[model samples]
Target: MRFVWRWRRNPLRRRSDVVEAWAGVAAVVLMLVLGTAAGWAVGSFAHGALREAVRQQQQHRHLVSAEVVRSVTGTPAEPDHESTTGREGYGRFLARWQDPDGVEHTGLVALHQAPGPADRFPLWTDDEGRIAGRPMDRATAVVHAVLAGAAAAAGAAGLVEGVRRVVVWRLVHRRYAQWDREWQQAGHTWGRADAGS
Candidate 1:
């Protein structure tokens, strides 16, 4: 009468039904356990890797004061999209800054606002004094790690669900085929009144 009948001793319960029920239970349990384990493991690994990268960036990247050499007049057709500063009133200039090694380097830098004569702004550079983006912050690294962990958990759960669906699909087909065979056998003696006697 109820779906739970599959788990109890009943004449109407077929072997395939019992197997399907157990399989469904197993799938739910596995999805939860595997998803959680995968999420935690991937999250831990990603956090450790990102933290190490942050440390390396902090060690190798230096922020130094750069003087604006000359302003590039007129907005170029292509602006520096990667500029951390907002693009409105954006100013492009040839800037010079000294590296940690006391070597001077000049490059085109984008600023949020036009600079006055002898104006200076902070710029990030590598050891060789080439312009570089700001180093990754700890908060950003943590957020990325959390996102990766969530993705991994979802992927694990999806994989488990897919496998369960495939197994259940096969079980259902087998059950249907078994029923078809029984029906065909019964059809052979359908008109015989003494068939069951």
Candidate 2:
């Protein structure tokens, strides 16, 4: 407590103290901005890259086809009807079928839109006849791009703010130096006058 009081009363420590405080504030703000940008960039990049890699691996690959034995909405409604919509309606599809090698496989595909009950979407399987990956829609790609760009912008803004604060500190320090010199000169002059008298 005594140390804190002494520091608060110390005139020589005042300018340096203000500069240190402002520097700490600038550092915190910069960290927040950079951290947010980095996180967003990583998330966007991972999503797009993984999706594309999976799609490429599945391209030109063939799978045994089968008819939809049953179609039902994802909700709590009972399975009662067949959907006639195009590929756009195929939000999520579950297919149960057998491969050419007499092996059975169940595949799940997530589509941008809902697919019809009878719509024939391509299924890609590995050597083991396991469903590997599916193609991603254009809308999902766009979202990833947007998120990455936003993160870059946030990082840039943080750097700019940090630099601005540093410049402000330099200016404040220069002014404080000039004021200190002036005050010391005035005190010396007063002392000389008192001694002469």
Candidate 3:
């Protein structure tokens, strides 16, 4: 049968079928308009929030120069593409530094090259004087925001599709039930010679 049969003047078409067709249209509209809008809004919000965090981290953290107390002899972990600039592959070392108050501290720190015991390195520290990595740059913050937006959009569209599927499935069941009843009504006189008349 043609897909538009529900809109045609057919005696066999049921009211449930028409409702299902309208629901299908609504689903497409929602996926296009509401879903896309929701994704864009969430993405924008995420970008702002992440960028703010980056700014705050920059404010709260301070850089301090430290000297390597001992050499890091063991091999360092493989650096991925996202590692800080100049830190291409593998390198980290134990270093010590004094904060603004002259308090001494030591911890593992990543460096572009192995540091000698006498070598001095610059490292970042949070307000509590704990070692910290560089803050999120603008590019990285945007990337994270975009990813979060995409995830939220997919979730919204999936929910709409699921609801559409359930409604259509129920309509199909009703159609089958109607057919079964019709078949039963016509089946009782199947063997009678005058049934066709």
Candidate 4:
């Protein structure tokens, strides 16, 4: 890990040693600079896109009161489960709602609790009265952007490290090959009277 000897005027130091030392320094600098820049750029882009999506959804989506017609047992393919907010899906019901454009629609809607006939609950819908999921809130969007940014930063750093390792490996191999060639020449003159002279 020490590069002091590479920089000094040592007879044992090969040119490749100095190159490896400089390569390490460059790799470290690149990792820091590239990681930070990539993270920031990705985070900012994600945040802006998410915010725009939120705005569009809010503008186009509408919340309407849906009246339960009847409850039905969930099928295996559509088993009821707890939502991300930890609310249990007690059952599903055939519900009817009218969109802002006065268009009526009916569909299976999940309820947190057993619903009696004619019971009403709020439901989100699109312009055509089709059911829709809730829009992403600003806070959730920000969190997602941050996580994406962190992943990008780590990815960038990992790529830089991998490149550095590959370069060092090739340099080491080249140095070993050079040593092998020198050893072969030395072997030819081994045990000769002039070998050490």
lDDT string for model 2 (54-115, tens) is 47655633455643434545634223222322344455566666665768876455445445
Winner by TM-score: 4
**Evaluation by lDDT, superior candidate among 1 and 2:** 1
lDDT of 1: 0.86
Q: Per-residue alpha-carbon lDDT of model 3 for 133-184, expressed as tens digits?
A: 7777889999999988898788788899999999999888988898899889
> lDDT score, residue 124, model 4?
84
lDDT of 3: 0.80
Give residue 177's lDDT in candidate 2 (0 to 100). 88
lDDT of 3 at 14: 80
Of 2 and 3, the candidate ahead on TM-score is: 3
Q: Rank the candidates by lDDT, best first.
A: 1, 4, 3, 2
Q: How many residue pairs clash in each candidate?
A: 0, 8, 0, 0
Cα deviation of 74, candidate 1, in Å = 8.2
Off by over 4 Å in 1: 1-3, 73-91
**What C-alpha lDDT values do all the predictions have?**
0.86, 0.59, 0.80, 0.84
lDDT of each residue in 31-79, candidate 4, tens digit only: 8999999999999999999999999888888889999999877433234
